[model samples]
Target: MIDCLTGKILKKTPDTVVISCGGIGFAVQVPAATGGSLPAPGREATLYTVMNVTENDVSLYGFATEDQRACFKMLTAVTGVGPKAGLAILSVMTPEKVALAASSGDHKAFTKASGVGPKLAQRITLELKDKVGKGLASGTGFASGADVPAPAGAPAQAVAALVSLGYNTSDAAQAVARIDEDLPVQEIIKIALRSLSRT
Candidate 1:
């Protein structure tokens, strides 16, 4: 229930920080990036937090933003992803990138984090592909583009082509979302590739 914490930083390690609030110091496990984002030991910072309680242990995990916190929760919800693995993913990619990877079927991105193997990475993508954008991202194009849904003929073909070329579906859709839907799939793919390269 520790939704957030605001206080002076008492100590910090690679993936943990101790925050002092009202003279009480709280040890919080955080993504390494979150620990690095904080100021030195005396300055104040705030962490959006989630506390997990189990039969044997209770732990507090903190995130740099509500988006990261939400992303962490979403990632942890996957069948084999524990809090540490969730933190590992966030430590490597931001919430936005996580959404992008999930939607794209780019499971390799998930594997960059320690303890997340090929199977787990693929599982993460499969499980979250349709769900990450619901709460974890906004305007991330996980909705890819709000004005349009995944297209029918040429556009759908373009998306498929992009996916075959190693681009993820969400990214491919976003890249082609604003282009003319009536164009040939090849033309759409070319335009999308051009546009995506600039990003």
Candidate 2:
């Protein structure tokens, strides 16, 4: 039931972070979208959280923005979707893109996520399309300007590589956008790796 957490970032990895609050450290799994926005370790950050409880384990998922958290909640509500799967979807696609894909019945886009298959992708679109509009209207879906930063120069090429590696277009674009335009290809790759690891 923890709605949010504010603390010093103690550690970070591609998909996980440890935040220290009140002398206790909390490990939170986050989507790539949220991971890219995180400040460096030792900085203070706040994340909206969704706590998932089960018979055998408990996990906390964190989001950089309320919109992303809302999207996660919506995604997990589909019958066959679990928190990890929802995080995988968010890691690949932004909430806005996800809404568009669902509304437009773009099963291919939905299936681009690591573990999502054709049937589940189609089912996601079928079950979530109508609900997506509500989230969009409420401003809980992806905002128009919400984008990850990417590095500079040959962005299109880098993005293509990332897409080939299974990252969705939005994620690739954002990661590439964060790079400086003058950076060399190797530097760009390094930055992108750093960005992806935050997820």
Candidate 3:
């Protein structure tokens, strides 16, 4: 039932982070997307969290944003998708990409995540396609070109290319915005690839 945590980050590993609040330290597993954005140790951080209870153990999963936490919840709601699996999915794809994959029935994208099989990907798309649109739309959807400012010089053209390549306007804009203004289109794509690879 723990919905959130606000504390100082005491420690961090690839899969988990320890946060100190009051007099206690709480360890929470996090997806790579959230982990990448975490502040260095000793910095104040806040995470939206979900508590999972089993007969033998209790664990907490944390996200950098409510959108991520909500996506985690939605992923776990599917049959055969547990917390670990859900985290794996989020670790590999952004919430926007995930929503797009589901809504567009792109099982191949889902299958790219570690531990997710083709069948599971298909099932996820089939089961959650309708539900994902609302979540995806909640924050400008996956194609909100406005979220990420366009790069200078041929910015318009780059955005058009991204749109043609299956990315929504928003996703394309964010990806382009992450690149240097002077970088060429190919370099921009490379940078975006590196960023996505980290996820």
Candidate 4:
């Protein structure tokens, strides 16, 4: 039920952060992306958090944004995906990329995460696709371009081109998917970059 915590950072690490709030320190597990964005120790910061409880243990997971925390919740909702696995996936892919990949049925993109095998990746995609698709189609959840269906042929090439430029695979794919598939790769990339830069 703890929605967020805003306090001074007592410690920060790649996988966890200790924040002191109201004279108490709470250790929160976070993905690498969130960890990297955190202020240094002794600096003030805020984290959106989710608390997971089991018969034997209770744990806290944190993210830089509500989008990320929401994604984590969605990820852990899938069968066979634990909070640690969710963290592992988020460590490599941003929440936006994960949502795009899920909605696009790009299972392979998730396989890049540690501990996510092809089978699990496929399950994650299949289950999440519908959920995320509903959210996107309803215009209630993700930001723009999240559920874009990658166009056939040339648009795929444009997505690949953007991936080479250091953009997340699903993100690039969704961006290219929003444009005309007949456009040349350069134009697609240019348009996608412009769209992405605005975010």
Candidate 5:
């Protein structure tokens, strides 16, 4: 199995990238965010990759981070979710948001993806909820983004506030979730911002 690829980017697109390693160019499909975050063509970059093989087809998918690759593995492990659908979900929502949605049982959040319907969205949440919860309880964030429950109330408001200030949703949620105790909305936002700024 190909664990990852590190090479000069020969081409980069929203859904795929061509990385020239040694004397070969490997074309790997990727989520929009991963493609967007990668260095421009000709620059050296690394992608955590998973190769999927079927009876007649072989495909490779890549991610910018190990967490994202782990997220993809967990997503595709679902009964009805395919590789395309998994990338679609990750393209729109980061791993942190996926964990947040599962933790809160917010199936509607995933409906924003292009091909994701309510039923599939609900299944995704239901299947991953246990994994997320167990990972949090075990203090392991390998697949899930956080090892804690998603913030709510003042913390939720703080997350929104951070998002409005141009922070990424994943970053905002994680920062708020890290604050163990409850605080006022302002305090939550303040602490979250401080946490985010440091990252």
Candidate 6:
């Protein structure tokens, strides 16, 4: 599976790098983050890699760390998100931010990636809400600390309040997940409504 490679860098471009290992040079597509982290040409570096194969082409993608590779794999699993788009997202946002956006249902944050529109952004967050953390590279946190982990399940009253405000049951639940459960129901509703309004 070519899980990883360590070698001297032979060439590099904006999103691609060629590393020479055992006299063979391998070309790999990389996210901007990985690209920026890579050492200069002639310098040795190690990359965690994934090989993608299809009907007519074989491609290799590399990351500076296994966590970023894991993040790449998870992002590509979403419907309508191909490797290029997945790389595009990682190019702009760190894995932690992506995980935070998914956990908090902040679809707008994903739209900052090139070629990611509102619908795709929403689908990415909605579909990954429960699944993202498993593969997320740990240690990535929002600098603002707004991506606080949520307690499982949503408070019924909070869900109801958001629903009454025109949010779907699922979205309301997702938004309410960001609030502290210890707070009063009214407070939960108020905070959830405010968070949803931002999305």
For every candidate structure, what is the RMSD over all alpha carbons to the true structure, in angstroms? 8.6, 11.1, 8.2, 8.7, 8.7, 9.1
Candidate numbers sorted by TM-score from highest down: 5, 1, 4, 3, 6, 2
Candidate 4: residue 28 lDDT (0-100): 98
Measured with C-alpha atoms, the lDDT of residue 81 in candidate 2 is: 91
lDDT of 4 by residue, 1-199 (tens): 8989999999999999999999999999999999999999999999999999999988899999877787787788799999999999999987656765786688888899899999999999888776655444433434333332222245555655666677765566567657775678689779999998887
Model 1, stretches more than 4 Å misplaced?
133-199
Better of 1 and 6 by TM-score: 1
The estimated TM-scores of all candidates read 0.73, 0.68, 0.69, 0.72, 0.73, 0.69
Report the lDDT tens digits of candidate 5 across residue range 1-199.
9999999999999999999999899999999999999999999999999899999999999999877887788888888899999999999977766766764567888898779999999998788776664443333433344422332345556655676788765566567666743578898778877887888
Writing each residue's lDDT as its tens digit, candidate 6 over 30-86 gives: 998899999999999999898999999999999997767877787887899999998
Candidate 4, after superposition: displacement of residue 178 in Å?
A: 11
**Segments in model 2 whose C-alpha atoms lie over 4 Å from true places:** 133-199
Candidate 6 C-alpha error for residue 1, in Å: 0.8
Name the Cα RMSD for model 2.
11.1
Q: Against the hidden true structure, what lDDT does model 4 obtain?
A: 0.78
Q: Judged by lDDT relative to the true structure, which candidate is superior, 4 or 5? A: 4
Which number leads on lDDT? 4
Higher-ranked by TM-score: 3 or 4: 4
lDDT of 3 by residue, 4-83 (tens): 99999999886799998887899999998899899999999998998999999999999998778877887898888899
Q: TM-score of predicted model 1? A: 0.73
Off by over 4 Å in 3: 134-199
Count of backbone clashes, every candidate in sequence: 2, 15, 4, 0, 0, 0
Q: List the residue pairs that clash in candidate 6.
A: none
Residue 134 C-alpha lDDT in model 4: 46
